[model samples]
Target: MALFPPKNPVPTPTPVPMPAVTKPSTLPPEDINRAKQLGTCIRARFAQTLVGQDNLRESLITTLVAGGHILIESVPGLAKTTAAQTLATSVSGSFKRVQCTPDLMPSDLVGTQVFDFATQKFSTQIGPIHANFVLLDEINRSNAKTQSAMLEAMAEGATTIGGQCIALPKPFMVIATQNPIEEEGTFNLPEAQMDRFMMKAVMTYPTAQEEQRMLTMLTHLGSDTFDSRTLTGDVVSISDVEFLRAAARRVHVSDAIMKYAVDITATSRGAGTKPVQGLSTLVRLGASPRASIALTRIGQANALMQGRDYVIPEDVKAFTHEVLRHRILLTFEALADGVTSDQVVDSIVQAVPVP
Candidate 1:
């Protein structure tokens, strides 16, 4: 008998007709121009502070425009924290950074009721979670109990304290960073919490040329700390970010593109009527409906950034890895074989027919 029994083959069902692609709404030329300008300014500021990792920069901007949260994973010294902070500083919004640790408590994140002896009353003191842009640095270092405290805020844009629900500041977004190289004193984020993030950006070491440029830039700056305030001319207000987000929402998405995004996520599950070959053996779980929704929204954001008013297949393909990398759960065999989620996503993307 085989170590893992692989017996049944799923017979393909008769194909159902896909819905007709409806015309999508288009953004005004002025709005499109504004989006392009904002994107360019943000990227330019990022370039001044960071050497490379263009993809990571784009992912951060895309997530911001899509009104979604992002999770960044990288080894130490990759500038993950710097990238997030730079993006936060680019916008004129309240920013807070939480250095997560095993001792962090739920009350330390959300607010807590404090007794006001002088006033003879209790007051609700807000925590760092109330900021417009919140960065949870080294999130995995915190215990699961402390991590659970973020679920409500991240999912509903509100946090509960002492039976009172308080809304987070407008244009709220969470940028979480985790170190993949460290496993000791770390807790694995639950799947439910992980799904809350719209995208997971994996950062890698920069190329030789990029590293050399970084050295020269830092040496010229005369210090290791890079001040984002130097790009004051490029800073955008909260209203500007809201405008770009509205533009992204208006960017048209055809039914064909919608289906294409859904198909890519579905094929990963091995639960679809027509499953990809060997997918079931490798994947223990697949992405949720949220993944499909994220793909569409991020695609719209990407389209707007590229000076287009409508999403295209290329828009959907551009960020497929970032969108689905964290959602898929691999089996033991796949891990033993050293297969990665990116490889799995590539296979699924290839298997699904492009619209």
Candidate 2:
């Protein structure tokens, strides 16, 4: 299936462009340069381990800088797990991979109170969710109950263990992967849980050149398994991640830009005083306020990566599909007509006025 509809399916509306703002970014020049260096370092490290999927790499970095969780959907053998693992290992922190299954219990992800016979006392044993980077491979393979257990950690960065709330490590992020091809024995993620993610990235197959490079790399290694830890010398420290996030937060966001984001989200929902045309019928539900916030923050991250202190319309437009795809729910008619969330988002972007 096509990820998006044909170009210009919806009549292109003349964008009512707003006057450009002359304000500069709040971040200092040194900080902006540092952010760019960090972003480059991460991409370079990812290139050493993973073959291609530039969009996936950028999405991961943007989400990391924005301090948000991500949901990755793709078929098997697309290196979804490899990408997540490479991102985790590129940073100097604890990394954990949870292979989700139907029988996986909540305690398997969080933690449980264990009774120790040797000490005649109960001790708290934390689970894999406490790590800095957590890769939940095949997340949908687990039952809803087990999936919901991650809510607390993802939202609040803390989990309640035996009536005690334990804070997770800082610089924490969840990169969840789910196979779209296999639906049997897999439970769908709840809407509430879905909304918790800042962005949902969809990975696609690589090009012929990229695949050939993969084959060459595999032949050079003489094995199928690729160890991402080979680039330990170039690992980005936790402090660097914190600094990059701080810099991203400092990236300037104007009121007009904020309004543009809200407008795009509102148009998708077909809500407010003036909803954009041609979207109400296709959308069962629009993106939430969180999506608006995500759109703005992701723009900030993108701007920082580009060595700019201020966000532009292009930054927000660059990630609109990723930010709003999983958030919007489609109607029966839209689905029957083979409409995707990407198409809906594309139409909204074209219809909304740019600031």
Candidate 3:
């Protein structure tokens, strides 16, 4: 009794379980080194399969690394479809070509519900949009309804059928091709849908020498060419491709650069330039927040593709147009005056100070 008990017993607090600390990948030394090696191999392989268009090819590669969609506008027979197919082959991804026409329907691109007489219930028949790489050939040729069908998958990466949303395959990308020369039967993509694409690239005709070389290559290769050689026999597994994209989310971007991207985009809206040019004056709409995001990722991807561990201003500059062009919308007045979106973007880039 004299000894009694300890003055008072204290209650101990339960330990809070912290998230598993992930060790930062020091594998940059190894991973990036291998990525660069694969990139080199890809470049060499593409050079053989395709001629010229170095800029476009690099942009396409950057798009893949950036995990974004691309819209290619060009005349027919310029290998637009071939370029998309070759790209898919290089990545060893499933490819599907959608011949968009006026008669094309939403179900045509995203599948539809079918009545299974035996089962006495409706079943979902998936469409070509389920693949890893989809070539929306002549997208502009499709009617507004048909074009709208792609909006969901392009933006959400999934299609809803029979009240259930089906996720697209990993590394999914839609490389849409539109013929800008022919507007007679073509339906221009509404501004809303255009912005869904990360970049709108124009595929121009090859030069005389390049064309002649392409012709020679075609004539000389008599059934010797396989569909397309696999770049690494599996350099990037589907899962690995998903992982690489997840890693991109961790790509560091300083606030300074983020502001730079915003400023450049905001300036396109109403911020004035030398003559006080405002996109509102000429543009019906300005680039959205998604545009900024695309720029950041694409910029980081551009840096990574060049074997750099970090992103820089040059990367942003290189990707600015592609990221912003399609997102910016010019008014009818601007169109009547022949003021193109490219010109507007150029002005904004010049006006916005580089960081």
Candidate 4:
């Protein structure tokens, strides 16, 4: 890693504001019969209700099927929160939402021990993280201490409280949102924690047509309360999603694609000759091996979503931006030079040869 890499130092511009639930999880069927159908239904429902954010819908669905945490960076009113809740409803899973505040505590998320008055025994009280789907809204607004509590569940499916680690629910997934363009009263996520996320998705503005559709949907739903709970119609049985996840683990990737994925990670490293022509100077650090692994798993999920049993390079490239964008740290020099991680990823994908 370089002691210094040219990167963006621009003061994060204060940007637009964003506008933004829990239920018992029915055990999904044990069979993997409807996983593919579930994935398609989730996407379709989002398209209908979300009105826009096509890119977010695609990347988020990929991460969900892959079973990984995602960090979404966008201004408010972009439906990041709504999307998380809606996805949870699509699967009929238990959902929990935590509003990240500066005063939030670790125990508030991971849980603590409470003394039972009758027995004088300290029983464990689980926190919001025990649910199958969790939405950590405005994650950066919380202090590091509060943020630390999420690391375990997000990374290991367990959280430590009262000196004990409690396992979270099966198929746990967290969709954490941060305001990347704001600096007020927000704590930067520790690098170690950042690596735990499978992807950092940037939500872009909706198209004019999409925005118009959103308005129309809002008009149609007037007084109807288009809440996330409404997403629970028969999409796929819970069992089907479970089976699909198991199937995704078996999705085939050729060795050539594997090597190509590794090469991309290695080339992103700032230590050696830069793999992408102009990036060496801009990046202080390259994508981690975890990034490589995530890329592969996400590729499999992509293939699975597309009803393919095997992965292709295009599938790998499909998620490169979201999977590696935050993993690659840009140098102050790169920022000064107006270089973006998206550009670096593009350069690497274009320059890397397919096998």
Per-residue C-alpha lDDT of model 1 across residues 116-142, encoded as one tens digit per residue: 999999899999999999999999998
Better of 1 and 2 by lDDT: 1
* Clash list (residue pairs), candidate 3: none
- The per-model lDDT (C-alpha) reads 0.91, 0.89, 0.78, 0.80
TM-score, cand. 4 vs. native: 0.87
lDDT of 2 by residue, 1-355 (tens): 7998677677778999999867654888888888888888888888777888989999999999999999999988998988898889889899999999989999999989999999999899999999999999999899887887898789888999899999999999999999874466777788888899998999888999999999997887677775874564477899999998888888899998999999988888886435667777799889999999999999999999999999999999999999999999999998889999998888788788886
TM-score, structure 3 vs. true: 0.86
Candidate 2 segments exceeding 4 Å error: 1-25, 272-274
- lDDT of each residue in 1-355, candidate 3, tens digit only: 6777767777889999999956334336666665666567557667666878887888887888889999988877787876777777766568788998889999999999999999999989999999999999898888887777799899888999988999999889989888884567887788879888888887778999999988787776554343664333333456655645655555566777777877877776775333235557787878888888888888777776677666778888887888887887789999999999889888888888787
How close is each model in CA RMSD to the real structure?
A: 8.7, 12.3, 8.7, 14.0
Displacement of the residue 100 alpha carbon in candidate 3, Å: 0.8
lDDT of 4 by residue, 317-353 (tens): 8889898888889999999988898998888877777
State the RMSD for candidate 4: 14.0
Better candidate number, 1 or 2, judged by TM-score: 1
TM-scores of the candidates in the order shown: 0.92, 0.91, 0.86, 0.87
